[model samples]
Target: MKKNILYLSIAVIIGLIGGYLIFGNSSDSSNQKITEVHDHSEDSTNEMWTCSMHPQIMQQEPGDCPICGMELIPAEASSEGLLANQIQMTENAMALANIETTIVGNLMEGNDDGVISLSGKIATNEENNAIQASYFDGRLEKLNVSFEGQVVKRGQLLATIYSPNLVAAQQELITATSLKQSQPALYKAVRNKLKLWKLSASQIDNIESTGEVRENFPLYATVSGTVAMVMAAEGDYLKQGQPILKVSNLNSVWAEFDAYENQISQFKKGQKIKVATSAYPKKEFDAVISFIDPVLNSSTRTVTVRSTLKNNENLFKPGMFVSGKIKGTAQSAEESLNIPASAVLWTGERSLVYVKPNPNRPVFEMREVTVGLRNGDNFTVVSGLENGEEIVTNGTFTVDAAAQLQGKKSMMNKSGEKTMTGHEGHLGMQGDSENKSDAISTMKMKLPMAFQTAFQAALKPYFKMGDAFVASDASQVSALAKTVLAKMKAIEVGGLGKMEKSHLSKSIAMLDAISSSSDLEKQRAQLVVLNENTVALAMNIKSPTETLYVQKCPMANGNKGAIWLSTEKEIKNPYYGDDMLTCGSVIDSLK
Candidate 1:
């Protein structure tokens, strides 16, 4: 609920604070116009609105934002800076996003050392674990330890069993007793044989003194611990040395963390680590790294680093997600310059951050930095930064987005100048293929070639699903959705920018929803949103080799209109299939 309000407050804060800042000493009538300011032309006052969260949506009148369902607010365009790669944001916009910045100093000048963060989970202490098993073959007559997590004590009565072997052994003792006078050696051997089966000496003496045979016997607990698993059931036949329960001592537990292959050299046994858990967020438990796995996990490329934690207070539970913080990443005696991890945008081998050239203004420009040793949530900047510089520590994505919108240098657009194709409409919706316009006013950045080429390959199955949808074959759509989803998942996201990642993630989610159901209407409904995101993604591709046309059907999405990408300029409507085949116009193309 609070998150929803925060999103809504962005527009409200911008409208209120921005209205006063832009038009001070204005009349109440002029201030009222701020809520629904006109776009397109000066005479078109209150005639249009756009989404606050999604700026792509531009409608003729006020309505709920189609993408996020938030109420539409009047759109405002801001001018870019004259300097290269520089962009500015209004104080209202900054306040609306709740963006914050921090001035970083060289850690090399300070005495503080960096800390390493590790992700792991709590596990049982394996050394203290034991198995409780039966000593001899028998039928379980009764079981006292019936459930997992049950506590047991040493020498406690655990179960009762009926053993035919013990019954026959008793008969042997009875028969041997008669010959004891003549065969004292046989008597001694029979008594010692019962001991091998874990029978008490008193039990052997009772049968001999009473001259009777016992069919049932009691089993006792061998160790004291909490039962981790119950392996046996009442009335079940048990074999000799068969396990009945798995028990583990809870006095101490193991906090095992998976350290990446690159981070393995920094970790060593006997190093002190401070562990924190979600259950106890405020507290940190001190533990020593007792063991590190000798072999690295081949698939995960990580090694298990184990720490023994005392749970005398019963604070830790097995399977709880935990984090381990290790200090001392600083190799140099003098601490190096470090900034919060959030301040850096890491893409492949490069690290980028938005630096405020002037400390007093909201101006920001992207800078590529060389990062060295990383400690916990901070990274040491080896180059491209200076002490006393203010960098964006939060809302880095927002700032990058603002830069891209203003045609300034961004994570996606590394160049200081705009790159454009003479295409009409921002999202390929304003003009048909026959009437393509040369208006290239918007920031003309395209998705990187590596990402675009990979995505194009993955979208092959997606286009096939569109064909299936055009044929009204729900089953084929479901199958193709799964195929495309797999291909999409296989796409390498290591070098993709944040915006590309978001679009790809959303497209994958839409495909998942489409494949989960076999209903044609439901699949088409998901396709509507899928096409929107994919179409936006396709707009980012620069000079694509494969031809892809953005086709739109006016009657789709309940008359709100929708667009889909196709390989050819010829439109085949997937929304209505046979009902409205070839009903769409080609709005844009990628070639």
Candidate 2:
């Protein structure tokens, strides 16, 4: 009975301990699973969105970046919340920033002629000039065609000249006529003498028959045309073989043109050319090249090309300025893209054009193009683009500005350095340096807000009082000018496309001029103009991105300027000139 009772107790205790161990393990496992679920949720909340190359992008949801087409990453939530300086924008703001995209298409294209407008002076055709000269020594006793541009006809009597030589020749012919009755051989000799004096056979016969001497002889017009040169006047003595007047036949005139050395090859004899004159702006006359001068003019760096035209109305006169075009065919195949010269942003070495994926969107992408022969205003794209690409023509400058702000490729490098591209370097600038004073006057007289700020500070010294600058002080003046310039650089004046950094480079160069200025009065005068120009440029500036695209600092020798003073990673801007420096920013949030 005792052994059976002990066995029952042992069974009950063992059963109780086994049940406790099993229940404890089950509760621990349940707690662990709950913690795992919570950790997983936290991880999902902290997920980030980033680009494969540009990790700066941060998005709440998964999407592709408009700039690089990379998958977006989730932003890492900061313990401090959103930074005050950060560009945290709503979806609407993003749209206003023009952060949009479009699809590309393919299509056929036609060859377009580029119309190059060159400002030139009007001139007369040199070959059409006529000079009338006295055939014998005589005195001009009367005048017929007096003033310049007098029209005359062929064989018309221009002037009567009293000539002793003519009288002597007529007497010799009479003597020969008298001697003919006695000695025929001596008569031939006297007839030859009169002929040597330029006496015609009819005049000789009349003089011989009448036995009279005419003192004044009538000079006939050599050609039927306008008198181009009049050398002899009434009462003026003219020598033998001396030119007294010039007449040209306007029935046909030669159009002489200056052909540049490079363009000389395009011209061939008998090729058709179309000529236009400012005087006759609406009319176009056709001419055929009769000759291309074999020799090139070293001084003008051109070859002379001659084209003949019929001047039936006598409208195309000698010395009348005219311009003409000759169509040239290229040996190679035509290009894929067509663009206007104005559409390209010249960066010194490379030609850049902005392409819009969609016309509805204001933004665009920068494409470096290989240019072929320029027909006129249009440039043929030998490579770098396809057909049906929409290019920005009128508002290229505006589009370029937006690209620069968005940190995309631009016409110039960050240092404001330019690239060499085709014949674009030869084209004139938007602001020509030839008329510096005119451009400066236009800027200062208007006094736009940005220009006022930039110029006021830059010209403060000059405005306050006369100042002198030496070459040694050039760098110092540059520093002061840089201060105001930096501020002006941040502003966007228009929406043309993109601004070339070179445009601003000229403004920056003014600072160097200020430093080197030695004469107070002279330097001050120049500085005034410079200040006005700076102000005007500030007002007209289109994009701050231009500064980034061409960040060329003149002092590039280790002390050179930087494209971005700080890396894209850094959030603070030491370069910002105003409180609104970050306004309208179109950048991705940092993860």
Candidate 3:
């Protein structure tokens, strides 16, 4: 009985030990799996973040962009599945950019009828123009037409002139009439002489019958038209064959449209045209093409197509703008592929379009397309696209901007050059080295104290303008620019030498360019040029009472770099303003 109890105990203890080892190992394996799953969750949450404006910046966690200071968003997914020239945009980005797409199949199917649109202006018909000239040399006594655009009728009295020669001729005619039977030849000669002065036969006969010599001769208009110009005023002396006024019959006018070289083939003499004008939107003018200019205007790259319209109501006036549409038969209406003008992105000589590779994804690839004729709002695609392919139409520039940011093949950067880092401190101060020579030369040059005072006074408004740019106040910048222009003009250059005056003149010109611009970006761009000229001027004749810091920004003017003058050593970049408030460095100091 004792041996049986002991064996049972031993067996129970062995079973308990085996159970403990099995359960303990199983619990440890389960905990290890849970820890591995938790670590994966943490890794998934560590997605990279980046800025949309400054795409080069990357961060491990969400934060503001270091350069633009904009809130960073999740970085774009790895571009492993994208083509070298393709980019993937999120749906939210597409909505923000207003990007729209359309299938490239039969876009012009119903609309392809070979209708050419043209833009031109109304002009006076040169054929209906006439000039009224004085028939005899005399001094004006009475004038009928007072101003241009006065309506005149044929044989109407235009002016009355007093002439000693006409009086002598009238006296000769009266004397000759007395001896008509004895001297018929002399009488005929005197009558013919009076006819040369445009005198009426009745006037000559009355002078002969009454034996009176008239001193004043009345001039009559030969043509009925509106006076276009009045060359002579009342009491003005006139000479024979001198133009007194110009008249034009507005019963007919010309609608001249410019045709580009490629469009010249579609136009021909006697082609029918329909014209409309903004002045009379409801009315349509119909006419046949009267003439097509044989010579092309090299400067305008256009040829003039003229059509004469009957202006019975005189509605069409010279210099009024008009649009025309030329109706023609299409040579291949079924084979045409046309896209909207907004879809095409032109850079220098290349035309680009963002083509959607897959209808399911937001992946777009930059494509170079061959373009043909330009219809009203569409362009005919010559090649490079196939049917059923989708393409971006609106917001093409936005896509190009993104492509440029991605360092992909874009309209401006066809070679896929890497984007330049324009951050203030990313590159170790690039422009300082180039301006060192200028700074050395400038430090050596000196000007008279009076000239320096005037120059410094002229720069006060400019400094204010820089501050306005820093504040991003466009209106304030415009006002300050004008004030700067005024101060620059008020600068006395009489004390300046020839070279100094020339330099000052160039600087003033650059200032004028900036002051005239209403666009802030354009003003900023002009400011870059103005800074260059101003720096050169300052180098030669810097202010003595104040210290000027010449600052440079590598990110300005499309990353080509720009410089400006500031009074402080700390940089307040005007080009970028709040977007990149501290995006520049002081290149040199001027005193």
lDDT of 2 by residue, 1-591 (tens): 999999999999999999889998898889999999989888787666543223344565677643234346544343233222111222332332233322222111343233221112223455666777777888999988887778898778888999898777777777777678798998888787767655567866777788978888887776677777788789998898888877766677777776655655566888877887756789988877787899976544457787777778767766565667776644422323445554656653477776665454333567778876444445557777776677656434434443333344555444333332111121111233343211111121233455435434443443222111222233233334434344434434332222323544434434333332333433333343343234334434333322211111111111211111111332222122232232222121111
The local lDDT score (0 to 100) that residue 501 gets in candidate 1 is 65
- Residue-level lDDT for 134 in candidate 1: 85
- Which scores better on lDDT, 1 or 2? 1
lDDT per model vs. reference: 0.75, 0.51, 0.74
Q: lDDT tens digits, residues 1-591, model 1?
A: 999999899989989998887667576567667644643356475555754334445677787654334567765554445477777776655765457898878433443465677767789998999998988889999999899889899989999999998888889999999999999999888888888887788888998999988788888887898899999999999999999999999999999987766677788888999999768879999999999999987644568999999998888888777778886544642446788766776443457899998877778889999987555546778889887888998767667766666577766566745432111223333333354432212224456677778788878888899999999987678768867876776677776655466567757766756764557997887797678667777777776668877777867865656788899887789999998898978756667
Supply the global lDDT for candidate 1: 0.75
Model 3 per-residue lDDT tens digits across residues 329-413: 4455457677876687654356688999999898899999997776666677889887788999866755766777788987656
Stretches > 4 Å off in candidate 1: 1-84, 106-112, 178-189, 276-284, 297-302, 312-315, 320-323, 332-334, 346-349, 370-376, 414-591
Global lDDT for candidate 2? 0.51
RMSD of 1: 19.8
TM-score of every candidate: 0.59, 0.49, 0.64
**Residue pairs in collision within model 3:** none
The 10-residue segment of model 3 with minimum total lDDT is 422-431
lDDT, residue 349, candidate 2: 49
